[model samples]
Target: MQNAITELEELTLNGASRSFLKETAKWCKFLSIMGFIFTGLMLVGSFFIGALYENLPQTQAMPFNVGGMMTGFYLVCGLIYIFPIYYLYQFSVKMKKALISKDNDVLAKAFEMLKSHYKFIGVFTIIILSIYILAAVVGIIGLVASS
Candidate 1:
């Protein structure tokens, strides 16, 4: 473990690695910007969902407020999506600055942001999968009870 830590401390980016990282940062910035735009669109659309659904004849037959529920669901999704996008954006900006300035602290922070971005995605995936599993189990139970 100590040897691994020592080797990690000694690690340095070669010219090729630096070039690759710079390219990666550019792509990350582009993707993050796109994500932000789409998320903003989703949020904006969420506000209009209720109005749109109300105009539909089918919505009136439903007992519950499907439009309001959909709006809230979309808003929640947009808010949850922002965190990873922001982290990616930060990583891209910090990485570019770090590469240009050769600043170790900035580079470390950039990597930290990248780590955060992936961590958030990983956790979100797990939570969503868990929800799916739980829903499946409940569905099975409901079917069994109905039979």
Candidate 2:
């Protein structure tokens, strides 16, 4: 096993790649800020949802508690959105430091954060897709049962 191990090589960024990384970092920071704002809005809206439901008589008679469910949904969205935004923000910060200092270690860390951001988004996408599929199946079953 010792013989099979090899020494790790250092990664070097070309001039163009360095420029691209800087540009990507800027975009990531912008998008992360936007994401945080949206998350904040959703969280605040979750609080107001119950108030709206209390004031609206039509929602009171509904079979399901739309206000509570909507609040829960919004809270979940905000919680879920936090991860990617944090990761993107971290990537942006670390990438800027790495570029300015020309530090390979920092650059690696930045890329790792970038990976985390995409990984969270990819998993979230799969979960949403699965939920959609399940909902479609349930809808079809309901239609058939009703008929």
Candidate 3:
């Protein structure tokens, strides 16, 4: 176990790959910024939904306060999006620092953050797929009933 741990610690990016890592870090930073901006837009849109809902005429009110539901859903999605973006941003920053200083420890930590970013995205994707499958099943049942 100790030998395995030591061998893992020895794993490092080749010097030739430094440029590639730098470019990847740059792209990650850009994408992270865009993600944060989109999350902010989503958060703002959630409030906009609530405001729109409040202004709707009583006659237009949806069957289960769907407007409020939309707002809540948007807010939750924005909040959930924050975690992956933050992890990616941290990875970008740490990766840059690691490359600059040639610090293996920082590089490892950056990779850990990258792993966390992917883990969050993977789990979210699974959840979304499940939702899609459920919706499809429900739609099929509705179609069968209508027939």
Candidate 3's C-alpha lDDT? 0.92
Query: Each candidate's TM vs. the true structure?
Result: 0.93, 0.87, 0.85
* Whole-model lDDT per candidate: 0.96, 0.89, 0.92
User: What is the per-residue lDDT of model 1 for residues 1-107, given as tens digits with 9 covering 90 to 100?
Assistant: 57877887887899999999999999999999999999999999998997787678882368788889889999999999999999999999999999999999999
Which candidate, 1 or 2, has the higher TM-score? 1
**What lDDT is obtained when candidate 2 is compared to the true structure?**
0.89
Clashing pairs in 3: none
Return model 2's CA RMSD, one decimal: 3.3
- lDDT per residue as tens, model 2, 1-147: 333334235347799999999999999999999999999998999979866865676833678877788788889888989999999999999999999999888988999999999999999999999999999999999999999
**All predictions: root-mean-square deviation over Cα?**
2.3, 3.3, 3.0
The deviation in Å at residue 6 for candidate 1 is 3.6
Off by over 4 Å in 1: 1-7
For model 3, what is the error of residue 22's alpha carbon versus the real structure, in angstroms, after optimal superposition? 0.8
Q: What is the lDDT of residue 147 in candidate 3?
A: 100
> How far off is residue 118 in model 2, in Å?
0.6
